[model samples]
Target: MSKVTPSNIEIIEIPKIEDPRGNLAVIEKEVLPYQVKRVYYLYDVPSSAYRGGHAHKEQLECLIAVSGSFEVVVDDGASKQKITLNKPNKGLLIPTGIWRELENFSSGAVCLVLASEVFDEDDYIRDYKQFLDFKNQ
Candidate 1:
């Protein structure tokens, strides 16, 4: 088994450029405080449920609720942290080796994730005990 160290979560505010029609925020690859290699969006989620029951060995990610609100639960083998994301311009950064679970998603909520790497099964740490063992090594 492997021990796990949760990544530091930072709240980044996306600069909104105001316009007559509405507002816009452009997220660039490296300009987003961290380099981004993959982008994904989640929607149509039910209530009292959860997602992301695993940890990434090397993948760093930022999550933002573009439409509504949601809760991100992160565990670091020894401790746990919970973050609420609601604003479209605010995002939570999850570093590697942290087990994360996403829950309490509002009906019309849209979650956008910016990842540091592409899809790789080898990067995922699914077992909590294994995560703890890995971190202790």
Candidate 2:
């Protein structure tokens, strides 16, 4: 497998439609690189709590803050980067093989996740040392 890095993650601008009531953002067809097989969300998370302490082996995901805000810390084996998601019209695309940790969630924050694959326990790498070894091999 090819090496994955924090730089591999990209902030995607979702198309917006303005209206008299409220603005609308859409994600369909070409907005994402892969077909979405699953959808999930996190809400009402405590600010002091942490989530997403694993990396996917083959699945890719796009995360969006549809409500409040949060921080995503992405790491390759060599380096790491922190990304803030505060806009509903923006989404962070995380490719396979990068370890990710989600933290610093604002009160009432809602994080929506679009996945390219269905949930499978075997696809997750939950240990950091094992993630590094997987990267090396």
Top of the candidates by TM-score:
2
Model 1 off-target regions past 4 Å? 1-7
Summarize candidate 1's per-residue lDDT along 24-126 as a digit string, tens digits: 9867654465678899999989878788999888898988899999999888777887888898877787877788899999999899999989999999988
TM-score of 1: 0.88
User: Measured by TM-score, how close is model 2 to the native structure?
Assistant: 0.95
The TM-scores, one per candidate, come to 0.88, 0.95
Q: What is the C-alpha lDDT of each candidate?
A: 0.82, 0.92
Best by lDDT: 2
Q: Which residue window of length 10 is worst by lDDT in model 1?
A: 1-10
Q: How accurate is candidate 2 locally (lDDT)?
A: 0.92
Summarize candidate 2's per-residue lDDT along 60-100 as a digit string, tens digits.
99999999999999998889988889999999999899999
Cα-based lDDT at residue 27, candidate 1:
70
Q: Assess candidate 1 and give its lDDT.
A: 0.82
Clashes of each: 12, 0
